[model samples]
Target chain A: MSLTAANIAAKPKPAATEGNGCQRFNTMPGNGAQPKTNYCASCAAHDKALCSRLTGSDLAEFGSMSQHKTITAGQMLFSEYDDARYYYTVISGDVRLSRMLDDGRRQITGFKSTGDFIGLGTDGHFTADAEAINEVVVCQFTVPTLNQSLEEYSVVQGRLMEMMQEEVINLQNHMLLLGRKTPMEKIANFLVERAKKYSGVDLDGDAITEVDVKLPMSRTDVADFLGLTIETVSRTITKLRKNGVIALETAQHIVIKDIEELELIANGEA
Target chain B: MSLTAANIAAKPKPAATEGNGCQRFNTMPGNGAQPKTNYCASCAAHDKALCSRLTGSDLAEFGSMSQHKTITAGQMLFSEYDDARYYYTVISGDVRLSRMLDDGRRQITGFKSTGDFIGLGTDGHFTADAEAINEVVVCQFTVPTLNQSLEEYSVVQGRLMEMMQEEVINLQNHMLLLGRKTPMEKIANFLVERAKKYSGVDLDGDAITEVDVKLPMSRTDVADFLGLTIETVSRTITKLRKNGVIALETAQHIVIKDIEELELIANGEA
Candidate 1:
């Protein structure tokens, strides 16, 4: 379906707190009746955030400057050309960062999951749109506050730099995938990466054997991320399954039956 | 041509000093006849590197940690799977950063020009190979020395973080181009970006007219960088020229005749 501001506005709005140092704007009136507190110590991403580098009062100070936000699936957290007021860190679920051409062609730049940082553009305006692929929770802080915290905490600044470098590396690898990898190779690489990122190890005796990977994004999203059509993505998955390299547990789950073989295909050795 | 380690090692080596607080390894035997000193203050990228943020003793200390080297065209600066011991910043000319699959498919991730930083991978091993597209000069520094300098100078750390963020942004834009843009749109975007980056404005009676953009990399390199075939790249350039949107002064240089129209095509609005 085509995305428009008016259509997006008609969806369910996120519920946020309005008073006691936390102010939230509801996209739909009376939608945010269930108020929530913006506490960082109890946050899921607290350990992965820059605030984790802080100690005692410093952590409390950072918590006071941050807010917790929950956005529903298909809801846009922000759009292209919007003024970037707050930096974000994903706490749960998935967020798709994308840019759409005027003719409606969309490129998914990234699928940000737990612990991934967002909205750190150098320019005042965002160059891409960010939407929730599932129910997503994020920690938000103003740019000024983030900068002040960075100046006050060197470790925090160092961590932020490290994350940005990680982002550069991730994007570079994606470029290789989109520019060179064949359809099957792209699918293999995607599965391998997802398994490494979000898989649970299944131990057979003292040695680890397999992993269970959950894919939150749809096949269409995968096609967009891999720079292929939906038909190509589906065909490749069927071929891999036929080749006995992978097993489908459900629509949004996969089991890497032959990981070594998958790795060979991913590296283009097969 | 297929790139192999032996072929790359057979190219002309980069000249470097062997002793006197600097050690440089020659990639090929009997290839370096000229030796050079490690002088950061007199370097061309002095105002662009991380050392530019240093002052007085800090500047001198950073200078002691950096080495300047000139690499000839077609020579590999560093290859994939090599140890990423040093970070580099281009002082002059262009460098191509690319990765090749085991089956020989290669993708050019970026073309690093003057003031662009390279070799900032997080893992110990380099993920892509960097080669000098032309005779190029670069400033190199070890990671340990860079970290020590960061400890001594917060501004240097901040500046490094900013550059990394810029790299992330650049790669994200390229992701959109590779994944979504049509061939015409891709070429249009590439030209517009290059013009903005390297163009010199010619003013006719203060009215501000045409822009002169230099294309240092070859057509094949541009094709690989844009994820298109060489034939498609050449044909698109010819089409643009015939359409009166751009004029070719030489094979390696272009004048954006109608930048406004080019911008519209780049955004896919035309």
Candidate 2:
């Protein structure tokens, strides 16, 4: 591990949380577009917690606050502990969440896609960086309004709580990936979740099971997230493809061919 | 890294959402202590999003829900991917959150203390193991009610969201420790945070200015949590002590002699 002088003493705590690090989002600026009246109209996962109770102005505010911005691959959205200016919703495209060590090595913690919220925090601050994994679009909102709304709406609080609960578990999931599993196991876990999350179309809310999760991230990024080298990520993907369990359209597009076999691989049954 | 077939597929989805793997807990059964009023008048961390919102029947139901259990050192309270039967508020002692690889090596994730909640989940989970770093008292609640309450309260959601945000960042912080910061830097980060979180009495809204965070968890656990061997944790702490940056009252008790200096270490300043 490299210990730098910046590692010597902590920076003075900012007296007031500043808005300095807040920068241009990589999309259409401002909380511009209006979302469909019912974000959950076609999804079952919608009512689980977030946005479950709001259908009117409250929902509109939450929806309205989102300004979709498209970022080119390699552009940074925000950096760690930046003035917690905004929170984001993945409208489309994949974003990478990561932390950089003093020496410049990076560990990608997650690759977020549509519907995932990034930059959730307290004390009106951020603690890590968010970067676009590919050309990506995200809806951004200032936290002040959201914070105010949370105070006024118990329902919002409940949903946020559920999200937090989910987060704690998510970190634990990361722990499982970083602290426990190998590259193969980590890749399998990632693919399985993406499959479950992105699978199918909603046919009259019945949820059509047409699985197609295009990977917006590359091997190196995947390797970084899984705490493995890029070669390892490439080798594992190659192995999975060779096994006849999945069909790869590109490094980015994936078509899980045999759901059962994929599930087995995901379950370590293979 | 050990590559093995044992965990080709492990907890396929978020584990905490599952409802199995609890070691049934109950003690002093006859006390039949009436549940605390729904307001949770006696709970610590009042005003915290989780504690503040549980009022009257909610508080009563939330606390009454707690089945008391004692865990011995090294005994696991929960494991990754176990269905969460209960969300625990640490009543006494400390719990060490960690994950074990299939090969049996472990990484300490987070350390818990009195008033801290453990095994919280939302996607239907405990994603990591909560083990007793010291003999401990925990109040366990059923997941359904907590989920129900989460929907009913925004403060709760706010608190949970903050927590999830913290967990994600802490993991990110730890990744920094493992990937970038040196041993001394990691130890410094631990000291500064512990001092801030535990080492103070309740004064006004903020914790008292001069309180001590007694680490019930051991150096070994700290070493594991910081991604270093015990030798490193020991050597770093010893170095800190010799430099007058920290004072050791006992093996587990610490007092920061120089907070700013400690922060320097955390910030990677040399």
* Candidates, DockQ: 0.32, 0.21
Fraction of true interface contacts that also occur in model 1: 0.59
| Root-mean-square deviation per candidate | 9.3, 9.1
Residue-level lDDT of model 1, residues A3-113, one tens digit each, is 011111121223332222234422313435533222445557767665656656666676667776788899888877665567888988899999787787888988888
lDDT of 2 at B130: 78
Q: List model 1 lDDT by residue over B20-68, tens digit each.
A: 2233422313425532222445556667666666666667666666776
User: What are the interface RMSDs of all the models?
Assistant: 10.4, 11.4
TM-score of each: 0.81, 0.68
Q: Local error of candidate 1 at A99, Å?
A: 1.3
**All models: lDDT?**
0.73, 0.62
Residues A1-270 of candidate 2: C-alpha lDDT, one tens digit per residue: 000111112333343332333334323233346345444333232343355667766665565554556677887777665655667666667788887766566777667776676755334445567887777766566666666656666565555555555555566666655654556677777787777666644322443333566777777777777777789888888888888667788888877666656655554555
